[model samples]
Target chain A: MTASPTPTDAPPLPWTCPFCALLCDGVALARGETLELRGSDCPKARQALAQQPADTAAATPTIDGRAASLDEALDAAARLLAGATLPLFAGLATDVAGIRSLYALASARDAILDHLLGDAIMASVRPLQDRGVYYTTLAEVRTRADLIVCFGTRPAERYPEFFRRIAPGEPRRREIVFVGTDTDPAAAGPDTELEAVPFAGDAFDTLALLNALAADRALAAPPPGPLAGLAARLQAARYAVIVWEPGASGAQGALVGEAINRLVGTLNARTRAASLALGGSQGGYTANQVVTWLSGLPLRTGLFRDGLRHDPWALATARVLAGRNADLLLWVSSFDPSATPPAADLPTIILGHAAMPPVAGAPQVFIPVATPGIGAAGHLFRLDGGVVVPLVQARDDGLPTVAAIAGAIAQRLAAPASGAGS
Target chain B: MSAPAAVFELRLRALPRFRVDLAGVTPLALGALGEAEAGRVAIRHGNEALALGELFEIRRRPANAPALHFEGDLSRFDRLAWEMEDGEIRVDGPVGHYAAARLRGGLVAVAGDAGGFAACEMAGGELAVAGSVGDFAAAALPGSMDGMRGGTLVVRGDAGARFADRMRRGTAFVFGNAGDFFASRLVAGTIALGGRCGAHPGWAMRRGTLVFAGETPAVPATFVETGHDLRVIWTLLARDLARAGGPFTALPDRRVRRFAGDIAVDGKGEWLLPE
Candidate 1:
């Protein structure tokens, strides 16, 4: 692979930060001894870039904690998969191409596929499945939302550039309300008015009141003062968007999502309103989309010889690991080095970031792969689940992409073994 | 009705290391196969394909009806009797998720606890579990429009959350306690609970009848008390449930206080609290 122009001798390149789900493409990055951010000073982008030094040593593949050739590692992985009674393919933190290839391998090996953030992703998905949703994209929120309600989360904490990304180009009056949470200082602008409402009871209780009030239901007792005002404002707004982060919603986040959907549905009856979910970071959406389109089922589905079966709760990564339901685990994490596989006694194979530290255990094969947007060009679905953002490679690290490694393993699994191989 | 004599009995040889998919191994399907052919029938064990004989010891017996009996700790087995159109299936031990899902017509009985999504989206059948069940029992499949369109589901023990979610049509009886969001977003159905239940029962329900036969649950703020004139409706439902025999046998003698309105959606659903 040819190397791109280094930052020491060239100007900062227009870059898309793959650190978060926002995938902020408005920034420029200069790669020198340490990565420098220009145009936008998002701390998350800086922190992520700081982890990837300009002149870091490349990682090599290993078998059973000892150094091995890539071909040798692939062969060992294929052997493990072939013998596995149930192989779980998880930690899917790679781009679109990586998930596509992994799905093919999952089908070939009859593996059960799930993302590391499956729980958070399911928080949004469960509601969409139970009752349909009225959702809006980031662009829609940026251009047309007159009233914005951040429910149970401060988006800027995880997504540093969320407020900046949605800052309206033309100055117009916008009311920003925070429910069951404090208002984000980042949301303060010249034309923005902010307010916060305390929860009526718990989240469920509060949402129940809100849904009832929005639908004009005559409650025996009057609703909470702030919630009633918020409902009235929601009805009055020209275009309203309710922003929620599923990861922040706790164990019963799906219920929170459903409540948000109910509120949105009720408001849409009278006026314009929609919800914006902030999650699916680290290629969660990419894997879900790819798996769904390929097999007509979402993640946490098993491609059995009998047929496909999808059980979100039973097939959760934590549940599966606790039950020892799977005998082998194939974990792929190419974006973040800190994202490691959970401790399990099963035979494990990891296709991960080049800078990832050695994981402790035997009967494991570790193959370091290229990080998309940093070392190789790729595409990722944005948090809004609408647009696919093109990721530009900042450098050529010469590490094979996850797609290549997974594809190679699939090839090895399909091919007839040579005499005395393994 | 007394238990139909089992035409085929499948006893587990050993505990499987991985979950087995017993979806197509229904009574009618297995009854047609000879002893040798039945043993060779393919089933999924984890990711690998295995013959039925590898996992179970199959014994055939002459019977009048198409029936199959499973004897083992089948907690690692999933999709049991899935999509079975007609026949009788019985399990002596616990079964995993999606058991008897989409069952069009049949009788599925489990003596032990059932895993999540048990009898999910069942169109028509009679499913009875002697023990408890996990979440989403008789609920819709993920992204599906309706749940338990038609059937009779009776859980003698407790039930988990989201029970009968989006159920359009069915008559379900949970004789023990239930978790939160019971009968949530219910389109239309008749569900009876014989014990205490968790919060938010009958939430966002458009149409349905929820009968709390044991303990009256605290009604949500969205629902309001209505006149107690539903005796005609209650008598019709009670007659059928009483015949099923269990906690529901005493339901006919009880008077009920009625409440209506999830008003958040369509507020026509009713919750009958036994007084």
Candidate 2:
């Protein structure tokens, strides 16, 4: 990895901001006391960069709250895993390479795997598995969408750069509608029309009405006027894009996701329409994509002695911990320091961000590791799931990557014990 | 007089800290093995493979009936009688998840409550639970499209959420209340509920009959009331349900109001409410 040039030496280094799911590449970073964003004023990127200070002291590996060498820590973690009956690997917030090595380790240990954002990922995955989906990418929405519908959520609130990233290149007339939410002013443009339609009931009820009207099904009660109009507009548009955030959709989010797909399917029969789900941030998609490709199952799956078993609800991290099914927990969170492992009575091994604070418990192994975009070079899957963004290393923190730490532990487990040397 | 067949009884010696998987210890599977060989059967306790005799005390006795009996709380035991072909498997207490899943032919009777995904993907047989069941009972496995394809599941007590979701072909009778999203996305089946249900029952269902013999539910606007001139069809369905006894025995005597929809998916499923 090439070191970023000094600000006075040359222009800002071109970098991909891995702060959000967008993976914005049209940004430049200048090396200073901290990495500073030069091109974009995205608050999320600024905040993330500020959190990762360049001159910060590196962290060391520890076992049972006492400082230990990397080798000792690896051995301790391997022993815990070797004696475990059922191990759960959760808080998977790392890049592709990190997950690749971890998958091998998990396979050897017969561990259950789940992401920090497993619920959100399943909200989108379950619907696709149950029926199917008509989905769109960011590029398609920017170039082809004439009418965009923001369903139940305002993308700009969580994803700050969503509208700006998909800003149309040429001057063309477009309509933006926010159903069950207030219209976002940031989405307004000179050539774009904006409208906000209040939901007649809750999101579920409103979608049910829209689907019925769009399908031209007769209803005893009159439909909500604005919803009916929007339904007609969706039918008439050249290409419509429905935007939603599955993470914000609440507990029954899978049903909501399925409803959005149903609405998209209803419109596609008459006109062109597709949905754009805005989530999978913090390497959630990276871990999920890697695990799915390596094993035939998605996240929340277990590699058991019998075979691979994927139980989304039963094998959930919280459920597994509550039920005391797993004897050990291996938590990996290399992107964010705040993403700590859930409190459980079982022994834990953490491969986390370099700046992570000490976990308050006994029988724990804490090994601070490198962040993908900040301290190491890696690749991540974008929110849209179609594009893979190459993350450029901005600095060297003298920290090991999650891949290295996990690989080391796996190696220790695979190798037989050595005799004392003379 | 002819001698009676033997019955295999497994009594839990002690409660295990971790969940145990009893997938292959069904009556038909064990009946093929001698008592000594059956004791050597491998079952999963947490991550380790342990012999059946290590966890349970196995005993064989000559009886008039041939069946496999489990005594004690098997709530920590999962996949009981899984894919069982024939013979009877009786659990005196609650059983864990995937109980009798993919059951081809036989009877799995649980005297107590059951865990999630009970009778999932069942092809043929009967799973009768004396107590309530947890979520996704008779529902599809996480990603599979079909659930409880062919069988009869009779739950004597309340059922948890998403009961019979994505069911393709089967008949499920719940003699008590059910949680939300009842019969969701049901493809083809007959589900008869004895008590009240939670929100959004029969959401997105395609082709199935949801019979609510209890109080009328707050119906979704997408459903429209239809003519109730199907006395013959009701009689046939009610007679089959009555055979299960309990709350279903009085089902044929009640008149019903019919509503057709979940047309949100352009579905043809119906909800029958007793009038």
Candidate 3:
């Protein structure tokens, strides 16, 4: 049996740029209109963007799989939602603003507006919004941090350029350390320690590390060779960082958060510490600065019990979805809703921009708006507790701001609520 | 090195400064001023402990030192306060985790994504997303729970899993998407998505909001919407979100709808629909 030549003997695909969720930001266009796969970015074109096989997404997604006029596509989408009884207003989540618009439509129409993250992360985000906490961002890490740790997370594919901006060789360097198994081979550098602990005992590994360094005692997996010595290094570090990658199964996710608190508690005893997410591995999306500026909450609430409660389970988005609660669906998402309750069937109304490769099903009325980061100007809060990034909205066909749209809608809804607000 | 303490001024982008700490100090506790007290007010380092000027040339506070700049070797540091009340700090290169931990005010544009716990337990700040971030990018520390209180964490790119696990409050947004089991144990918060997210995000989330901007398969634990999207009031929140920097900031004055629940957790959470 001839196995044929490997990629070494074959030619490469055109190009794939995972710059956006559509994973269509930078794609390869062949001379014959037959596009080739781009590099690492196009996971769906290679791996999978929305559970749809790479080959499935590689079919050149269009509303109907055919190149139709822009108007025709919009009309078709409108038709789908108009006639759909159980229409779910879904977003591709390629861009945050686009999906938000769809969410508006979902809210107005009581449809399901969701994307991948909506399902994977939002479950917890819903409740967290009801609570609150403190944090920072990547921009802050660039020049501020001195220590970094890779927990149950990896930053390889999602943001390949991640290392270049924060590593030692850069104009402003920071320390690095790995606490999980040797998953990200590229993360290891001469200056940092990439320890390979038993993947199973990750929670215990973290506790053990903290105990040995912070409490001056051994806990789990006594850490061998360089790791044992690394404990002393960690304890002595003036500014230290910790990173953990939960890996494929996602078995250690729960422990990651607790481990972090413990690590920070211990590290704060001497040196300073900070953290960031590896890529798509997170539960909630930090809202723009305004949300927090006013209510001290993200999309939910922020009245914590002294110690900010970032617990989503407590708020119960699932219960809300199933209970058919909420007088209105205010989906102010930077992206699309990532989750859908098993029994969710709500009337969705949309009020934001529309992301392309629309979510499955249709909405009653879908209005496309401006891509905030691209068409308007605003302020966004970074992951770090207090960093605020100025948003530069690009003027695209003169669309009103999401705020304006929402304001107008609010005015309309308030008409009845206040009996005369409108 | 002219403008010593310029309050309420955001002078970034044009020209920034990076000031390194000569002495090892917990930058998180120490304000940006303490970290930047180089030149005139230096700290104790190794040997004789030189001043900030001795170790790294202080650009001086700059008649307008564009807020932030890169100073010394930060390879041995942590808790780089990327978030300043006002002003900027430029890290010419890579930095550590909690890069700008607990940032509450100001603009921080990172050239790269930070390490794990990058923005754990943050309150209020605008963290730019030029690159990507690690696990819990804007979430809480592993055991000692508590997600970002109130802040915005935007990721221009994708991220690893467990993004905002055990989050109590705040919103963590991703321009791209993330890996699996993302918001598993979320407490309360709103997680919006711009891209397709990974799998098993809200496994055991009790109460929180999960928004999917991209297409994804259905989750078994999650029940379909039992109610509907609340278009009218939803616009208010959506508007606020957009103005706050969401891509949908420019949506029209339409209605909003709502859906709810992870049947497992009382089924109270929801998905806001747009019309």
Model 1 lDDT tens row, A336-373:
88999999899999998887889997599999888888
Candidate 2 Cα errors over 4 Å, as ranges: A1-10, A53-55, A418-422, B1-4
Worst 10 residues of 1 chain B by lDDT: B1-10
Query: Cα lDDT of model 3 overall?
Result: 0.44
List each candidate's DockQ score: 0.52, 0.72, 0.01
Q: Model 1's A-chain: what TM-score?
A: 0.97
Q: CA lDDT of B8 in candidate 3?
A: 21
lDDT of prediction 2: 0.87
Q: Choose the strongest candidate by lDDT.
A: 2
Q: Write the per-residue lDDT of candidate 3 for residues B108-146, one digit (tens) a residue.
A: 556665555566677777666556776666766423557
The 10-residue segment of model 1 chain A with minimum total lDDT is A413-422
TM-score (chain B) for model 2? Answer: 0.95
Sorted on TM-score, highest at the top, how do the candidates line up? Answer: 2, 1, 3
Candidate 1 docking quality: incorrect, acceptable, medium or high: medium
TM-score of chain A of each: 0.97, 0.96, 0.57
